[model samples]
Target: MAFDSLSAFLAMGGHGVYVWAAWGVTGLLLVGVVIHARAERRALLRDLRRRARRAQYHGASGAAAPPISHQEGRARES
Candidate 1:
């Protein structure tokens, strides 16, 4: 199929509104997915870094201690 002109093709036989709306939704969804993936990756890396630091500290001290948990702190208070 050939359009009479670029503008005519964009009009898409009077269905351009639906076509553009669908494209807009798809673009926004893709952007949201990319943002979420990046955020999750950053959080995972941060957690790994924290664990590595804790392990290194224990190794240097030559003492193996259980990980300190927030619950443990609260239990100590009680």
Candidate 2:
């Protein structure tokens, strides 16, 4: 089938409302997914950068971070 004009093509045999609504919903959902993915990626990158800065700061301070165990602390002290 061929459309005689742009309006007729969009009308889609008088089901234009339902067809356009479905298309609009699908487009909006796709855009939402893209936005969510970008936000998550940015948050992950920011966390990674913050962690790197903390590690660098600790290294530059010249005192090693203490061990987590009491036994290790006692042995080091001895």
Candidate 3:
């Protein structure tokens, strides 16, 4: 089919409202999902790096307490 004008092309035989609305909402949500996923990935990576740094610092500082066995812990407590 051919349209005499741009308005006629958009009208789409009176079903344009439903069609355009669906397309617009779906496009918007898809973009929002991409943005949200990127943000979550960055935040999680930052937290992981921070935890790793703390662990490295503690290991290098040599002030970390030593682990004790269960029997040793009971003997110490007694």
Model number with the top lDDT: 1
Cα-based TM-score, every candidate:
0.53, 0.62, 0.55
Off by over 4 Å in 3: 1-5, 60-78
Q: How accurate is candidate 3 locally (lDDT)?
A: 0.71
* Model 3: ten consecutive residues of lowest lDDT: 61-70
Which regions of candidate 1 deviate over 4 angstroms?
58-78
- lDDT scores for all predictions? 0.75, 0.74, 0.71
Candidate 3: Cα lDDT at 9: 74
Angstrom error of the Cα, residue 62, model 2: value is 14
RMSD of every candidate to native, in Å, equals 6.6, 11.0, 11.7
| Candidate number that wins on TM-score, 1 or 2 | 2
- Give lDDT tens digits, candidate 3, residues 10-40: 8877988988899999999999999999997
In model 3, which residue pairs have backbone atoms overlapping below 3 Å? none
- Order of candidate numbers by TM-score, starting with the best: 2, 3, 1
Can you write out model 2's per-residue Cα lDDT over 1-78, one digit (the tens) per residue?
588899998998899999999999999999999999999789668755665676787776423444334452356532
Runs of candidate 2 exceeding 4 Å displacement: 60-78
Ranking by lDDT: 1, 2, 3
Q: Pick the candidate with the highest TM-score.
A: 2
